[model samples]
Target chain A: MSSLGMADKVAIALVLLALAGQLFFQSARRRAPYSKLRKVNAYQSADLLISAVAEKGRRLVLGIGNNLTDQGASLSGVAGLPLLKAISRRSLFNDQKLQTVSGDGVLACLSQMVTHGAYQNAVAVELFQPGEAVLAGTTRFASLAGLLPEVNHRANGGVILSGQFEGETLLALDLAARKNILVAGSTASLGGQAAFLAGVCNLALGEDYYAPAASLETDPAAAASLRAQDLLRIIIAIALLVGAGLTIAGVL
Target chain B: MKKGLPIAVAILSGLFVLAGLIFQPYLGPYLGLVLNWAVIVGSMALLVAIASLIIYHARSILTARKGFIFSIVILASFGLSLVGGLWLGVDNPAYLKWVGAIQRPLEVSLLGLVALIMTSAAVQVFRNRGWSPLTVSFGLSAIFFLLIALGLLQTLEVPQIATVIGYIRQLPLVGARGLLIGVAIGAVMMAIRVLLGSERPYSD
Candidate 1:
């Protein structure tokens, strides 16, 4: 700690602060549930689409974006897991297909495990298939190409994309829109967010990308994490405002 | 114990890594070892993923599914790439060029298609979002940025115009920074959740 630079120290302080917030919220929720997560249009749309697809005997697709490895934007990739499990659990007994696709090998494997676990929890192990989760392509464009066919054929109900992706994913969103299938997406990348804003999807932007699990009320810890995120967001916003004011006042 | 073991391992390792990052001078070697182990495990997982992919395509071909022909094509391409990579060594220039010749154009063409889709999507944004304040602001900002990006404003070269353009560019930076802070906070909270065993995204 003595050898660490100023920036490193600040980063450490921030992490510790957030960690403290998380622990506090986690214990608080265990005592009494936190139920005040703000509404998210994307999750609502997903629920409606799932019901529609289940009724129509069609399928739904979840694109667990490509940036899942250590070398890429992995946090946002891992962030999609809770949503994957939630979707799999929700769609389990309905006889409607739920397929997941990813460009990264590790992410695809994790998705397969989570999906299979969902089946296990539902007591429907016989219905689970290995092909339900797929490694579409190792590269971004190839993965998009691999996913388009599934979107074309199976996504009769809707497509929900929740992961770290780039601008190319808008092409998939566009394709889904053309087919009149319900589309919803979220990404932590700026370009991807812009693309989603332009496309016809119920979109979750910025911190909302991390709120799906909490919004669904599936896991108490997720709700706690969202609270921690909000606490830190408020802290950072106040700091930014103060800094701007100081600069405007000619105080360094 | 099956679940508890993974959670414990995750928590301890996460703590150790965090400590190592903070106190790097003392625990650098241990940090390297842990990261190397992670790399090894990740590589093995990749192998398993590839094997599963091959098996999936094989089953499709065996069952003569609707797109069985594409399965055959995928498998053939996989085979060719694997054999070529093994025989010629992946770093060989000829092998790299051989792969790149096919990969580069396909990726570029896909990107071109994405640009076209983006243009169409931009047009549809108005229709889909209607005349709401958010959509109106988005439309106006986008058109403003597009004109700036095309150098139409730059061509005028007036001092006041350039100053206003500079301020406009800084406006996006402010919004971008706000978004970045939110994303960073969310990511840190998620990591903390994993460390505390409140979330088990890696649980099988």
Candidate 2:
């Protein structure tokens, strides 16, 4: 739309460099004897659920929350796509395939693509079923009424509600609890966080939403992104503390 | 090109939006056009989603699934909404009223469930986790939550109570702000990955 300004250019350059640095780490780690690792239960649980659900003869359900949009929760959903692909790929031979329920139209589209890609990897392009990803509803809560029944009945007992979710998360999580299904979800909103804390499921709070994606990749570069996020978080916390202190001292 | 084309479009769209936000002079004029195109594409996706949903439920009904009636209801709702939105025009008061009639109740009911879910979860947490930091916080918040929600603690009646509530309110705000910052960083990382073609969701 417009030319990038100096600050805009700088920010873009910094982000690109940071991402590139992560890639460099990914490549370099291949040669290194060892690399630091972090445990994210969300990804581990996804893997666990694959086996658990398969053994139980139940399908693994992926609830890509309806929060996905061009502006809102798009990145969060996009970040989780790799894992969706991973899970879909991993669950190829299972009796029940991965069932994706999404509330947003755009996300439903991407999820279909992800499912198809996974199939293309696992078997053949012809076997890619577009129905793998179902559109539940347009809004978060509206989607819940349509989604919960599907998960409760078809999924057998596994659900992952990772995406840009708002208040409606509580219902899905509650339904999961009633069905005694394993549920783990991440929330980006304050209300959603509260609901999540109170809902019956494994929690992915705040930015931990990206943990599944990077952890699932296990690429040193992808993992480096987590470290970069941690660095940024620390800086922000420090800035907040400084701001609070300065405000207390009546300084602008 | 399966992966390359989508990633390229994403990078271009992302940069255009970023430039529009930061520069606002040169790129701002085309921002609306780009956004409009996004809306059109998104609408197309929604249309496809509708078709998929219908086909899905139709299959269920054909199979005589236990809850096949629910499929009929879902289809009817879709038809009604389509007719309302398309025939009446989205801006028409009839459409607006119809939306509010349906959405308001759903929103309220869903929000109402939040309270019950929170209470049940808090109780379960205490029983299972046995009073961890989270449970303890929930317990403490429960006391003030009732006092504030029930309007027992009048802000004007007691200046100290008002100050306390105000301070407590700021806690969640601060946490939310921090979380937003975290989410932003994560988003940036994802954008960078897409731009670099390191992470392509479109291709195997």
Candidate 3:
């Protein structure tokens, strides 16, 4: 095969252009609206989550999953942070107690996000204690083990497991199930398998994790990125169909 | 100052790591070597955690606190596991056999305990929550049923049930695939947020 074919070169150029456009729009602070499909469940589960945390007067265990600094890009963590902020804001607005536990060094980041959310809702910073919001552990099983007891003992009102998770997610879900807590879970690309195994997540947000933040916060950059992603998915789907057709026709 | 410094270090280190990722072809090996030092530091932190666990347990034992027996068991397990690994070697068949024997019962018992807890909790929720519980219960039960019906519960030896369950499990993959595709797109957006420093995760 040639080092670089015409089609390959064009494809690479398109990808680069898309990435560059994304970077430019993100930097410029452009907001994009939901591309028709995602606006479906805008605030369906949000009210329940908010009420569970704010009115119920029970602790909210926000498991940010195993995506920490050492754990790479943490696509799930990014997606979950906005949702955490939104939930935290609602909790604070309702004068409800909100506690977060993270399995990675992202504790500081998560703590700040929660603190900021609290601040936005005119709540005290002291309420968002670094200790309360953070539990440092590495590895999935260890994190889950460390977290399960806390969730159970606290009688957490709502358990949000949004981020990158793995096989250990089953253990967390099992723990939540045992505790009779409201559990909402969303995973990024890597978390699909774990998400599949979780039999009882109340609100299974799937990839629409970014939707809560994007739709709720109206974060323009996130919205724009989501739009770009929609375009990309459509393009990829079309490409797949074409490829399949060609294959079926016995074309190279 | 204490919190600030760590945050600062995290930000600097994170930026370096991101830069390394972007220019990995040229900087990958050297960056990897630097990250190996990070691994060593992390391992040392793990040691601190283990030490903290020992200290807490020892304190509990001396104070005759609740779950002292559990502490003793933990300490004994830790000591025995360490000694056995070092003296008998991790690969030693005798050590493996002893560990496995202990492990099997512990695992099975823990799993069984979880199952019991889940059952009790489910009953309590249904009993107490009333109408609202129905939606959640139904969703959870459906998923649980599907997961079990699928090959996940195949070890129980009901082939007919497993076949039906497998097809049911396969049904959701299409929706899951769509969701995954959407998530991938969102992830790219998030990555851009990080790379452009717009998200500012390290910022307080």
C-alpha RMSD values across all candidates: 1.6, 3.4, 7.4
Could you tell me which 10 consecutive residues in candidate 1 chain A have the lowest summed lDDT? Answer: A31-40
Error of 1 at A112 (Å): 0.9
Scored by CA lDDT, what does every candidate get? Answer: 0.85, 0.73, 0.61
What is the model-wide C-alpha lDDT for candidate 3? 0.61
Q: lDDT per residue, candidate 1, A118-218, as tens digits?
A: 88888888988989999998888878888898889853678889888789988888888889888888889898899888889898888888878887778
Residues A203-239 of candidate 2 have per-residue lDDT tens digits of 6766677767566664444666676666666766786
B1-204 in candidate 3: lDDT tens per residue? Answer: 844665556656766876676567777897998788777765664465455556666776998976588669778888998899999999999999998898767666656665564554455544433556554754576668767756467877897977777686685676668777666566656665555554544333
Candidate 1: true contacts recovered, fraction = 0.71
Stretches of model 2 off by over 4 angstroms after superposition: A1-34, A70-74, A218-220, A242-252, B151-162
Model 3 chain A: lowest-lDDT 10 consecutive positions: A190-199
DockQ class, candidate 2: medium
Best by DockQ: 1
Q: Provide the TM-score for each candidate, comma-separated.
A: 0.96, 0.88, 0.64
List the DockQ of the predictions in order.
0.77, 0.56, 0.20
TM-scores of the first chain across all predictions?
0.94, 0.82, 0.76
Question: Clashes per prediction?
Answer: 0, 3, 3
